[model samples]
Target: MRIVIVGTGNVATVLGRLIIAKGHDLVHIVGRTPEHTVPLAKEFNCSWSGFSELHVINADLIIIAISDNALLDSASTFHTNPVPVVHTAGSVSMDVLKNVSSHYGVFYPLQSLRREMMQIPEIPFLIDGNTPEMIALLENFSSTLSPFTEHAGDDQRLRLHAAAVIVSNFTNHLYALGE
Candidate 1:
């Protein structure tokens, strides 16, 4: 499977690594900056470009691993006609990509990430697609990476994201204070 990762942050880097490690082709890395995008693509031995090239690029799947706030704006940049478009965000709904592609979904990796972290964490994937067939494709794709794949719709994903923030963020803050 050829996957184009469209983000330069922790999620994109980590997931791109996983996909490459799984023997799939990372066709391109599309970030907002050449500095960020080029290096990430190099790590996977693939080509890369800025968000401006999204409409012209082609891939089996386009994964937008950017932050939620940037998602709406980013959606305006891609064309997912012959392929599917999925975002790795819990808080953001799949509708964000509805206008861009008929085949759209969410591929949220339910875990915290850090650029410094080298070890592959146990990532549970919460996936959803606009149609059942698309969802099945996402499910198969996710399961190839993690056995802990689940089908979570927009509402459940949002609630899980909120709880995740409370549990992970709040506890981390408390720990920092305690230390």
Candidate 2:
């Protein structure tokens, strides 16, 4: 499967690595600066491009691994036909890709991912989309990557995200206070 990732950040770099390791093709790794993403693209052996280059590549799935704030804006830069696009965000809704395309979905991995730390790679995947086919495809894609995959709707996902913040973020804050 051809995959295009729209961010060279931790999430994108890690996920793209796994996808490539799984024998899938990573078509491109898009980022704002060539300096930021070019090295990662070389390391992953994928093409590097900026935001405007999104339309130039064709992939079965386009994963937006950019920050939550940049999602909507980054999404607006691409206008692909029927390409299944998914974002890796907990708080953001699937609606962020509202005007981007019909084949958009949410592929949130329910875990705190960081470059310095090695993740378990078996975290629960919160999957949702606009269509049944897209949802199924996401489920299959996720299951291949991890054992835990579930169909979490918008409301459930949002609530889970909030809880994650309290447990992960807020708890971390308390730990910091203790120190």
Q: Each candidate's TM vs. the true structure? A: 0.96, 0.92
Weakest 10 consecutive residues of candidate 2 by summed lDDT: 114-123
The Cα error of candidate 1 at residue 132, in Å, is 0.9
lDDT of 1 by residue, 1-179 (tens): 98998899999998988898788889998989888887787888999888877877778899999999899776876776768999998999899998878899999999997766688876899999999999989988887888899899999999998999899999999999999
Which parts of model 1 are misplaced by more than 4 Å? none
Worst 10 residues of 1 by lDDT: 73-82
- TM-score of candidate 1 against the unseen true structure: 0.96
Query: Which parts of model 2 are misplaced by more than 4 Å?
Result: 118-120
Q: Give a tens-digit lDDT track for model 2, residues 1-179.
A: 89998887888877877787677898889898988899988988878888887776788998989989888566777776678888988888898786777888899878777655444366688999889999988988887787888899888998998898789988899999999
> What lDDT would candidate 1 get against the real structure?
0.88
Clashing pairs in 2: none
